[model samples]
Target: MLETLLTHVASAAEATGETTEASGDIMSSLGIDWQMLAFQIIGFALIVFLLGKFVFPILLRSIDERNAKIEEGLKAAREAEDNATKAQSKIDDQLAEARREAKEIVATAKDEATAMLSKADEKAKQNAKHVLDQAHDEISKEVIAAKKALHNETLELVASATERVIGKTHSAKADKAVIAEALKGADK
Candidate 1:
């Protein structure tokens, strides 16, 4: 097609009586070849039509799908981040509550221990008092028994002395009078 167009141009130039050199010079200067230019324009238009019909739409759809996937991934990432934050908050709350409960348990245990200690002290004091009272009662009884034994020993000694001094056993009334007189003399 380019060769045929060039031949026609040469024929037209000859019919006008223009020399080949002059026509070549004019064509170079103008830089115009209408037929070749028209063909180039048609080829460019066909290529644009074919790309728009097939390749461009496919590329565009792929880009749109990729963008949608990216957006979905971003949304999922945001949701996961929010869930993590909520889980952390819940854990912190539970930890604080557990700490509070532990403290209360410790305090309650301390209180119970203190109360038990107080009760033990009071019971020990009561037991000590009871033992002391029992000891005092036993000591008083011992003192009374010792006094009775001493009195009986003194009466026997006086009766034996009176019988020895008088040289014979005395009447009961006489013994009683003599013993009373001796006890009075000892007091003086």
Candidate 2:
């Protein structure tokens, strides 16, 4: 069936005197010229080869460079963030240490103050006790002196009264000795 169709198409082309070797039955039917098709294919391949060798490489290199720059920028930003975190951590540690030290200092100061106050209070108590003891001793000494004076005066008075009752002058020393004997337990 295809052979008969080709023969009819060839006859028709011969009648028209428009057939050539480049325009075979099938190619002419599809309105394709072989030499012109070959030229177009070669032209398209040349264009692809040129773009691959020159323009494509340049464009790809530029894209690769851009990607590298973006990666570097991201790395730098991450490093900066990490450094900031580390610095903040250090600051926090320092603050904690400082607070701890301050507490220690305050505690030490309070302890010292308490000790000093206790010592001062003890000293004051000791001084007050000493003063009270001294005052009591002085009062006891004064009372003893006053008692001796009273006993001496009473002995003299008794000696004079005994001399008056006897109607005769006895020895003064003898009378005084007798009065002291009589008042032996009474004076105390």
Candidate 3:
């Protein structure tokens, strides 16, 4: 086809009396070269075919593999992040549970202490009451003994005075009877 067009252009140039040099100038002006254009087209087609057959598929497969690897890495990272979050949550829950347990222990301790204190207070009160009752009993016994001693001393003094007034000592039975009569009269 290019040759046919070139031959037509040459004949027309001959009929117009244009020389070969003018025809070459016209071709140059048009920037047309059959052999070079054909070689360039063939080379371009071969390069396209080679890239499509070998280079393009390899490059596309490599890109796809790289994208898959990146996606896998992203998935793994997301899973790790989720696992870290779960671990943190578990730790937080454990800490909360520990704190709650500590609080409960403290509360129980406080309650136990209060109970112990109450028991101690009650025991102290009971001991104090017992001691006070013992003291009262001791005081009563001492008072009764003192009163009996005073009565015995008075009886002896009265018997001795009566013996001195009469200028004679009385028998034991008579002394007791006289002292009894005197005591009875004093009571009246």
What do the candidate models score in CA lDDT, each in turn? Answer: 0.82, 0.82, 0.84
Model 3 sits at a Cα RMSD from the real structure of 8.7
TM-score of each: 0.60, 0.51, 0.60
lDDT score at residue 157, model 2, on the 0-100 scale:
86
lDDT of 3 by residue, 1-188 (tens): 64775576556655544444556677778997544555567558767988999999999999999999999999999999999999999999999999999999999999999999999999999999999999999999999999999999999999989779766656788879999999999999
Worst window of 10 by summed lDDT in candidate 2? 14-23
What is the TM-score ranking, best to worst? Answer: 3, 1, 2
Per-residue error for 93 in candidate 1, Å, reads: 1.1
Off by over 4 Å in 1: 1-49, 160-188
Model 1: per-residue Cα lDDT at residue 102 = 100
Give the per-residue lDDT digits (tens) of candidate 2, residues 1-188: 54675466556555544436644777889998655665456557767887998899999999999989999999999999999999999999999999999999999999999999999999999999999999999999989999999999999889978768765766688879888987995887
Q: Give the alpha carbon lDDT tens digit for every residue of 131-171 in model 1.
A: 99999999999999999999998999898897797766577
Between which residue pairs do clashes occur in model 1? none
Give me candidate 1's TM-score against the actual structure: 0.60
